[model samples]
Target: MIASPDDVLDALDPEQRQVAEAVDGAVCVLAGAGTGKTRAITHRIAYGVLTGAMQPTQTLAVTFTARAAGEMRGRLRDLGVPGVQARTFHAAALRQLHYFWPKVFAGPPPQLVETKIALVRDAVQHCRLRADRTELRDITSEIEWSKATQTAPDDYPRALLEAGRKPPREAAEIAHVYAAYEKIKSGQGRMDFEDVLLLTIGLLDDRPEVREAVQAQYRHFTVDEYQDVNPLQQRLLDLWADRARSLCVVGDASQTIYSFTGATPAYLLGFRRRHPGARLVELVRDYRSTPQVVGLANRLLAHATGEAAKHRLELISQRGEGPDPRFVEHSDEQAEAESTAKQIRKLIDDGVRPAEIAVLFRTNSQSESYEQALADQSVAYLLKGAERFFERPEVRQAMGFLRAHAISSGSDPEPAHLPAEVRAVLGNTGWSAEPPAGSGQAREKWESVAALLRLAEEFAVKWPDATLRDFTVELAERANAQHAPTVEGVTLASLHAAKGLEWDAVFLVGLNEGMMPIAYADTAAKIEEERRLLYVGVTRAREHLTLSWALSRTPGGRGRNPSRFLDGLRGTGSARPDAFRSPGAGRGPDGTVRPRRKVGPVRCRVCAKALQDAAERKIGRCLDCPSDVDAYLFEQLHQWRLERATEHSQPAFVIFTDATLTAIAEVRPLNERQLAAIPGVSRTKLERFGDDVLALCAGHELAIESDPDEFEGVPEPEIVPDGA
Candidate 1:
C-alpha cells in the first residue's frame, strides 16, 4: 500500500502518471500488454479519492470479469481508498435491479438463471429441435453472442446474414429456439446474465427518476478492458454515466480478440471520437516480458491488417534481454506433447517453478495428450478454465472412499504402498487402470482420478514412511489451498483462458493451420482476430517462449503445415531475427527446405479478379460470376443428403451444407481427389460419405451405410443450459 495519495504518482511511469494525474476529464488510455494499465487506473481512482477530487462512495469501476473486479477492489483498498464500488457489469446491474425492482412494480426481482443450457434444452424440446452436446454448446454460444450484440430474436436471421456468420444450425431454427427460450424465461419470471444488463437498461431508459438516481450516485465511472465491451454493455455504461461528467476507459485494440462473444474494440477505438475533448494516453512500456518476447509480439502485430491494426501499439520492453522464442515442429501431436513435457521437465529441473510455466493451446481437446504426457513425466499441472481437479465428482468420491478406508485400516502404510492403496480406493469409485477410448466427459473424469493417482505416487516418493491418513491430510491441506502443492502447478489452458496472465516460460503448442486461426475463421475479420489471438499468446511469455506445431494429429497420418501466421517467422531463410531462428526453418511438407513464396490474393476461376469474400474464394469464383454447376446433379446430391441425414438421424447440413453441395456440383469432381478440394469436405466426412456422394454424382444408386460407428457426426447448433 502507498503511504500517501501523492506517492501514487511516484509509482507510475511518465505516461501512466499522465493517466493518473488527468482525473478531471474524459480519458482514453490505449494501454498495451504488460504496461501496468491496472496499476495506472487504480492509482488514478485512489488519487481522485484521497485528494478530495471525487467521492469514493460515488465512484464506480466496472470490469468484465468478477476476478478483474476483485483485483481492482483489492488494489483500490491497498491504496487507502476502499469505499469505491468495483464490480462486474452483471453484478452491478443485479444489485441495482434488486434495489429498484420493488420501487418499479415487481414484488421481488426475478430469480437469476446462472446457466441458460437447461432452459435452452427445454426451449429446444418446445421447438421440436434435435441437438447433440456439441451442438447445444454451439447454440448456447451463438445465443450469447446474439444477446451480447443486442440482436433480438426476430432480427437474429438478418443479423447472422449481415455479420456473414455460419451458424451451427439454420438461422430460422436458432431464432425460433431463441424466441422459445425467452418466452419460457419470461413465463418462469427468471432472467439470464444478459437479461440482467437488458432489464437494468430498460429501467434506466424508461424510468427517468430511476435513471437520475443511478446517474447521481455514480458521477465518475472507470471501465477496464474497454476493448471487450459489447453493445449491451456499452448501452448500460452510457446509462450509468448519462452526462459523461468524468469517464476513464483503458484498453488495447490489438487485444480485442473476443468478437465471437460479440466483444469489440469499437468502443475503445472510437472513444476519442465520442468525446472530442478526451485526453488520450498510450502506454507502450511493457514491464512484464523481456525484450525478445516483446519483439516477437510486435512482429506479429506488424503483419496484422484492418482497423485494429491501425491502432496497434508497438510495445517497448522495460526489462532486459532474455532467451529468444523457440519455434519447434513435431511429427505428430503425441510426439509434440511428449517433447513439450520433456522441455517443461527440463525447465522445472533448471529451477523454474511449475506455477511460473504454462502450456497454452487453441482448444480444450488439445489438453488431453499434454495431460497424459505431463503425468508420464510426473509433473504437477492444473487445468485452467476447467472444473477443479479435487472438486470433480469422481475425485470427491475417490477422496471420500479413500478417507473411509484409511479410517477402517487403523494402521500406517509404508510410502511404497501408498500409490497402490490410493489406486485401489479410486478403482472402487469406477476408476480404471487404463483410460477411456475417447476424449469426452468419461475421459475427463478419468483424467481427474488419474491425476489424483499421479499425485499420490509423487507424494509417496517424497515421503517414504507416510500413511494413508497422512496422505489424506496432505491432500486436504492442498485442496484447501486450492492447489496441489500450495496452489502451485503448471497451467494448462486454452489461448482464450491465458489472457490477462503472464508466465515465466510459456509453451504455445498446436500452432497448426486449422487450430490457430481455426478452420472456421474464413472471413478476413475473423482471420485478423486470430492473428490478434496469437499476438496475445506471444505477449504472455515473460522470458522463455516456445511456439510449436505438429504435422499430424496421429502417427502415420498426412503431414500438415504450420500456421500461416508462422510462415515468415519460422524456418531457415526466414525474415525473423537471427536470434529466434533454428537450424532448419521453412521446411516443406516433404521435409525439404524450400524458399518462402509470397501468396498472392486468390483469384476467381471464371474471371482473373482477386476474390475478397470467403464464400467466393471457397468456390474459386465470384458470386456474380457465371456458374458451371449441373443443376440436376445438385438436386440429386441435395435429395441424397436429405435421405442420408434421415437415415443417420442427423440434420441435412450435418452431412454437408448447401454451400459445399453447390461447390461439389459446380466442380463436378470425378474422383475423391477433386472432391477433397471442396472446402467443407473434411477428411473424416470424405472417408465415411465420400463413396455415397460420388455414387450419386455419377448417376448411380446411393450406397447404404450399415455401420453406425462409421458416421462422422457434424453437430448442429443448440443451446447448452447456462452453468452446465
Candidate 2:
C-alpha cells in the first residue's frame, strides 16, 4: 500500500512541508540534525513527479555515498515514485563517461582503479623513493586532496603550501611521484576513481554534444549532503544543471566535516549568493533525541565559533522528557569499556533491543577494547562503516598473491616476468582482468583483483629489489590499521562515520582530553572542529546518551583529565571531587562492603594545607615551600613544550620528556651554557629552546622567595615525590 505523492506532504511537519512543496527553481534547505530532512527531500521528488512538474526520468537525485543513494531511492519508491536517477557523484560521472567514451577516441575508457594505494605505492617507486605503510597512506591522502582541490601535479607543492597543508613527504618529491603515477596510469590506459570525474569533465568540455545530452536528460536535480560537495563534484553538478537553476540542495553547514578531503560548505552556505533567486528553508525541529539530549547538543553548538556557528540552528527537541544524559568517569580505559558493556546489558534487560544501541568513539582505534568487553559479556554487537571493500576476504586473498610474488622477487627482480606471475595468481583464483558481463558482487571482486595487479606493476617499477616478504609485511600492517568488518548487532563506529545516523541509545566512550580534542588539534580552528565532532556524536542519540572517559589508558598509569567539552554540560570547569571514585570505595558485585582507599582533599607536602588549585594539588606542593624553587619557570617551560609539540605534530614527551623538564626545574639553569650541560638538553634543543628556557628561569629568580609566614600554620612536612 504505497502512498500517492499528494499524500506525501502529510508526513512532513510544517517546516518540512514547506521544503517538500518547493519543486521549482534553485532551493536550499538548511536542515539541522534529526530534522526529518530526508523525508522532506524524498517527498519533494515524489510530489514533483506525480504533479507532472517533472518526469521521474528527468530528475537526478545525488547523494554522497552509495548507501545514502540507496536509501534515497528506497524512500522515493515508498512514496510511490520510482525510476528516479539517484546515484553518487562518482557513479553518475562514470555512467556519462562510459556512454561518451567511444565517441571521443578509445575502444573503452580505461577501467577504474579500485585499490588506489597500491598504484600510489608504484608512483612512489617510480620516483625511486622508499615509503613505509604510514608514509604511503599519507601520500595517498595527499593525492586525493590534490585531485579534489584540482591542483595540477607541477603546481601541487605551491598549492599545498598556500593551503597550509603539511604532507608527510617533501612537496617536490610528491609532485614528481604524482607526475610519474599519472604517466604510468595513462600509459596503461586506466584511470583512478578521481580520474572518472576529471575525464568526464574533459569529455563534456571538449565535446559539446555529450554535455548537452547529459543536461537534457537530467533537467531537474537534487543533491543530498550538499555541504560536502568538493570542487570537482561541484563542477560536474554545474555542468549537469546547465544554469537551469532547477537544482534543490539540502545540507547542514554545521555538519561539514569532510574539509580534510577538500569538501567545503561554501557551496551550500552561499547558495543565495550563487543563485540570487534561490528559495531558502530552515529546519530546526529535531525529531530524534529527547529534550535533555537536545539541550546538551544546543550547548555544544553554543561553544562552536565559525561560519557554521553563525548559521547554526539550535535543535528544538520534539520528543518528551527521557533519561538525563549520564557522565561516568572511570580509572582507566579497561574500566570504561567494561562499565559501558555492563550498561548495554542492563539496557537490553530493560527491553531496549541490542540493535537500538551504539557505542561511538572519536577514532576507529578506540573500538578494540569495547569489542573485547562486549565479547566478554556475551553481548552481540556490530561494527558499522568499518569493512572497507579493499579489506574484504576475496580482495585480500587476491592482494596476498601479489604480495607473495613481490616479496619472493627480492632484489634484482625480472620486471617482464612479474605480469606473468600476477596473471598466474589471477588464473589460480578463477579471476580475469575483464569484469564479468553483469554488475554484482562477483564482478566487484574481479575488479578488485585487477586493481591489485595494476598495483603490482607499479611496485615492480619502484622496488625491483623488494621481496614478497616486504610487501606482505606492509599489507599486514595496513590490514591491522583498518577498521573491523561491519556486522549485524550493537553498532560501533567512529564519530565521523557515525554522522547522518542515529540510535535509540548511544555510549560515547573515551572522552578524555587527549583523545577527544586530540593532542594534534592545537589551533583554535582545529579545536572548534573537534567540538563540532562531539556535537555530531551527541545529536546521534534519539533517547539515552552516556558520555564516559577514563583517567588513564591502563591501570596504575598516570591520570588523565576529562575532555573540556564536558565542562559546560556538567556545570563545572573541572570534574567534581566524587566524579571518579576508586574501585575499593564502592560495593562489589555481590553487594559486600568494599574496603576503601584513603581519599580526601590533596594536601601540600610541606604545609599540610589542602591545596586549592588543582594544578598545585597535582604538583603536591604549597606555593611557599622551598621545593617550589622556580615552579613558575617550570610551568612556563611545560607550556612552551606543549605549544612546540603541537606545532611539530609530536608528543610533548618527544620534545622534552617529563624527566627532562623535572631536571631543568631542579637545576634552574640561568644560561644557555648551563642549559646545554643538562641531561636530555641536546645541542639542537639548546639552540632551539635555550633562550626561552633561560629567560623564564631568570624571571623566576627575580620573584621574592623564602616567605617566613609560609610555615606559620603548617604541620610537620611529609616526604612526597617532586611534582607528585
Candidate 3:
C-alpha cells in the first residue's frame, strides 16, 4: 500500500540516502562537516512520519543547542512532519522532570537550586582556600561534576578521586566547604542544571511507573552530537533505548570536544560492538566547506593525536575550490587585532557583510583586545556564552537592588514585587525594555511581570479612566517574576560554547598564548584538546572565518605571546597571511598587497605591562595617561604612558572627565549645585570637587587637592594637574 522506504532516497545523496533509508535497524551516520548528516536525519524523520511507520509523538529528535532545536523544528515542519518532537537533551529532560516530579513525589517537587560561584567564594572564604587565584568558572565546573554524578558532598572527595577529577589536594578542607555548600543550597531550595538531568535519570531508574511511561511514549529516539552526551543524559538515553530498537544516531568522533563536561565519544566508538546488529553508515562528503578549507581540516586531522585522531573519518571534499587558509603572525596583541580588523574592513569594502565575518577565540578573556580593535574600527560584533550580558554594570546594580529589596520584603507570594519597582524606576529614567519574550521557565514566574505591566499599560490606554495606581495594582497581581530576555544580535561565544553552532561569518579573535590553549595546555593531552577546539572553531564558519592572536596584552596587563599555532605564520610587516594560507583570508581585495607589519613590544608606562607591539603607539599620550587630564575619559587608562609633550593641569576623571570638561566648556555648569546635578557627579564628590569642576566649566583656573599617588613615578605632574 505504501512505497518502500527507498522512496526517501530521492532527496538525499548516495551516502545520505543510505543513512536516511536505513530505518529497519540501528543507524549510525559518521561524517565530516557539511556532509549533510543533519539534513539526512531531518529528512529521515520526515519520511518515517509520511510512511506511517513512526508517529510524530512517538519519535524523539535531539540537538545540541536551543537554536538547533528550533532550526530542526522548522525544517521538520517544512517537510510536513510537524509533530516530531525535537529538543536539546537538557531542555527535554528538564521538561520531563517538571512534568513527572510532582506526580511521583506526591507533593510539590523540591525546587532546583541555582548554584553560583558565590557559593564557591563563600567556601573559599569559609575554608580559607588560598588557591592561586582560581576563577569562578573552574570552581563551578568541579561542583557541576559533583552534582551530575549524584555524589553527595560527604562522598564527593572519594567520588571525584575515583572519577579522576583532581582538585585541592586537601580533601578534608574541600569536604568541609562542600558540606557547607550543601547546607547553604538546602536553605536556598534550588538545584543547578546538572542535578536536573541526574534527578530525571533517578526517577526513571527508581520508579518503574515513570520509566515504563517514558519508554513507551518515545518509540524511537535520535541524538545528534552523540559524542557529547554527558553521563546523566547517557543514562536517560540508555533507558529510552532499552525497550525500543529505534535509536538512530549521528556524530563524528573527531568532534568530541566536551570531555571537561564529562562528555566522551566512547559510547559512539563502542556503538557497533555493543549493538551487534546496528546498521552503521559512514558518510564522508565534506559538503559544507571549500576544498582548501577541507584540506586544512584534513591536515589537522592527520596531525591530530589520541583517540579522536585515531578514529578520524576521511573527509571527501565536495565543495568547489575556495580561498586558502592563512596564517598571520603578530609581534603583540594590538598589532594582531589592528591587522585583523583592517583585513575585515577590506573584506567589507569589497562587499562582504559584517555579519558574514566572525572572529573566534580560544576563550572569553581573549575577546577583550579584539573587541577593542573591532570597536576601534567600528565593527559591530556579538559575543557568545558570556554571562557578560547579565553582568552589565547597570543590570547588576538594578538586579542587586531589587534582589535586596525583595529579600527584605520577603520574596514569597511574588518575586516580581521588587524587580517591578526597580524596572519602573529605570523606565521612568529612560530605560525602554518591555521584558523578554517566550514562555520559557523564567518567564513563567518573574519575567512576565514586565509583560503584565505592559498589558496593564495597554489596558489603561483603552480605559483612560484607569490611573497609574490601578494599573500598578493589577500588574502586581499578574506579575511573573523571573524572565530571561530573548537576546538578539550577533553572537560572541567561547570556543567550547560555540559547539554545534554555525554562523554566516565568524571571527576567532585572541589566539594568544595563555588564552588559547590557555596557560595549562602545557600537557600533551590538553594541547591536543586545544587543537581540536581550534578545528571546531574553524568548522563553525559557513562562509567566512577569521583566526587571529595577539602577542601582548593591551597596556593594562602583563604581555603574552602569540599562540604557538600562529608562530611560524608571523610575517615581517603588517602580518597579513599569504595566499593559500586560509580559505576566508589569504588574498586582499583588488589584488592590493596587504602589508605585513613587524611587531615590537610596547610596555605600559604605569605598571610596565606590555601593550601589543611597539609600533602600535598609545592613542595620543596613552588614553590611560595618569596625568590629571580631567578633560579625558577613563582616568586609570593612562597607566604606562610615556613622553608627555604638553602641560595642562586639571583634576583626574573623578574630578571631571575630558568629555565632561568638553560638555562643561560647551554646556557650562555655572555653580556648585548645578555641578552636583550633572551625571556621574556624586553629592559628596560634587561638594568636595565642586570649586575645581565649576572653575573648569566656567573656563577659569582653580586650585585642586594634591595626591601622593597621582605622580607616583613622575615628579613633574605638577606641570598641569587636571581640574586645576
Clashes of each: 12, 9, 65
Best by lDDT: 1
lDDT (Cα) of model 1: 0.78
Write candidate 3's Cα lDDT for 215-262 as tens digits: 888888888988877766777788777887487889988887777667
Predicted structure 2, TM vs. truth = 0.67
Question: Candidate 1 vs candidate 3: which has greater TM-score?
Answer: 1
Candidates' C-alpha lDDT: 0.78, 0.72, 0.58
Give the top-scoring candidate (TM-score): 1
| Model 2: ten consecutive residues of lowest lDDT | 715-724
Which portions of model 3 show Cα errors greater than 4 Å?
Answer: 1-8, 115-137, 150-155, 158-171, 183-190, 387-492, 503-513, 543-724
Tell me the TM-score of each prediction against the true structure: 0.68, 0.67, 0.63
lDDT: the better of candidates 1 and 3: 1
Candidate ranking under TM-score, highest first, comes to: 1, 2, 3
State the lDDT of candidate 2 residue by residue for 333-397, as single tens digits.
76677778878877987999888999998765466567655643445677766544345666677
